[model samples]
Target: MRQLLAPALLVAGLLLSGCAGFQPLYAQPGVTRDLGAIEVTAPAGRTGYLMRQHLDDAFAKNHSVAPRYTMDLALAEARYPRGVRIDNVATRYEYVLTVTYVLKDLPSGAVARRGRVRVELTYDSADQPYASISAQQDAQDRATDEAARRIELELAAWLGTTAKVAAK
Candidate 1:
């Protein structure tokens, strides 16, 4: 029985450590985007579907393959983006997306990623009282576009950090 207990402990340790070595090609082990492809989901009564969509788009753009569980990505949704802003009045919205994530060997066993990225597009038509509605909207669109890029860049940084850790 004593010998059996020693072997059992060793096996358990190895199994647990295996998670550390199971690094994904993109992100960390449990911190992966999606296995093959990813799925997206948002909270009840929230409209951050775009958050998941952005991730999907990003993943597809990077890998040229659909995420494994794209339909189920809602389970992994993190942040949300407010809609297109047209004026300085600032139509305010919030996106809260968070999922429990485990990285290869992250501290606290969680990712600061919080799965929450803020996409705020500010249009200051108020600053230019002479600005036309069309101009404001156009500027806002550009802002939104920039915001999307910002989010993608942020996600890339997050993934990059994870990869850097893995190389160590």
Candidate 2:
């Protein structure tokens, strides 16, 4: 029992140490701070500007593996594809948000990554005009943000992988 006790204690200590410094093993080794510039383009007007803000923040936050040099969002034109007809039709005013982001390599003048994310929100008619329409809008915005976040997260992962491979 005494012989086994020291080994068990060592194992326990190692595990506890891991908990303190536990970074995901999938993170590529010796690959940090790529600092590559990225450009994000959206549509025109306030909605487009807001979407650009969302894209810029999401890109920076999600690009964990690679450090971004600079990020830009240009307001362009937006043409939304028709949304699918929702059933039940409980919502009075339908809300939809579409986001498109393009990442470019600054010095190289090449497109590195491009992605689009769209979210449609529906609210019950009965819930509106109860002095809570703003609440509904907030909820819809939250949902849209989540959707854009998820899409950006996936895109960043792919970008990181590509950048790492390309660097090598």
Candidate 3:
């Protein structure tokens, strides 16, 4: 029984291994290397600073290597009063951040990818000056974090696909 079970298991394993060519997107070779080689350029401001920081961390970029791609970013922001009090003052506010990015291949000077990512967050508007500012700042931080995450995902997927195509 043991000898038969060993042979059956070996056969099943071999068949399964040969049956599919499925591979995870991130598992592809050169994806991480390409991501780390991207250079990020964002506008100057608090929101832009936040976005750049988040993206750098997400990419785990290595500065020592020469960049293969340059990413240019355009950012737009808006704020609106959501819940209004009876006195016509905003009790809650919604902050919106929209970011458009263009990735250029440095060597070829051609566009590799174009994409946009948006994030929205809400915060309470406190009567106290410092408290209100703090709330708004918190919202901005959260929104940038989310936008950076989305951009990272899109770029990674694109890089993986590009690598696969090049490989073939």
Which tens-of-lDDT digit does each residue in 1-168 have in candidate 2? 999999999999998988985544235442223322234455566555565566556645334334343333332222222333466434344556555556566566566666666666654444346645564546455654665576566665675677568778
lDDT of each: 0.43, 0.53, 0.92
How does residue 158 of candidate 2 score in lDDT? 71
Model 1 Cα lDDT, one tens digit per residue, 60-104:
533665433322222232223344366534432332223322222
Report the candidate with higher lDDT, 1 versus 2: 2
Candidate 2 lDDT: 0.53
Deviating ranges (above 4 Å) for candidate 3: 1-22
**TM-scores, each model vs. reference:** 0.34, 0.51, 0.86
Segments in model 1 whose C-alpha atoms lie over 4 Å from true places: 1-64, 68-112, 115-131
Ranking according to TM-score, highest score first:
3, 2, 1
Winning candidate number (TM-score): 3
**Residue runs of model 2 more than 4 Å from their true location after superposition:** 1-37, 61-94, 125-136
Model 3, 50: alpha-carbon shift in Å?
A: 0.8
> What C-alpha lDDT, on a 0 to 100 scale, does residue 77 get in candidate 1?
24
Total clashing pairs for each candidate: 17, 1, 0
Backbone steric clashes in candidate 2, count: 1
Q: Arrange candidates, best lDDT first.
A: 3, 2, 1
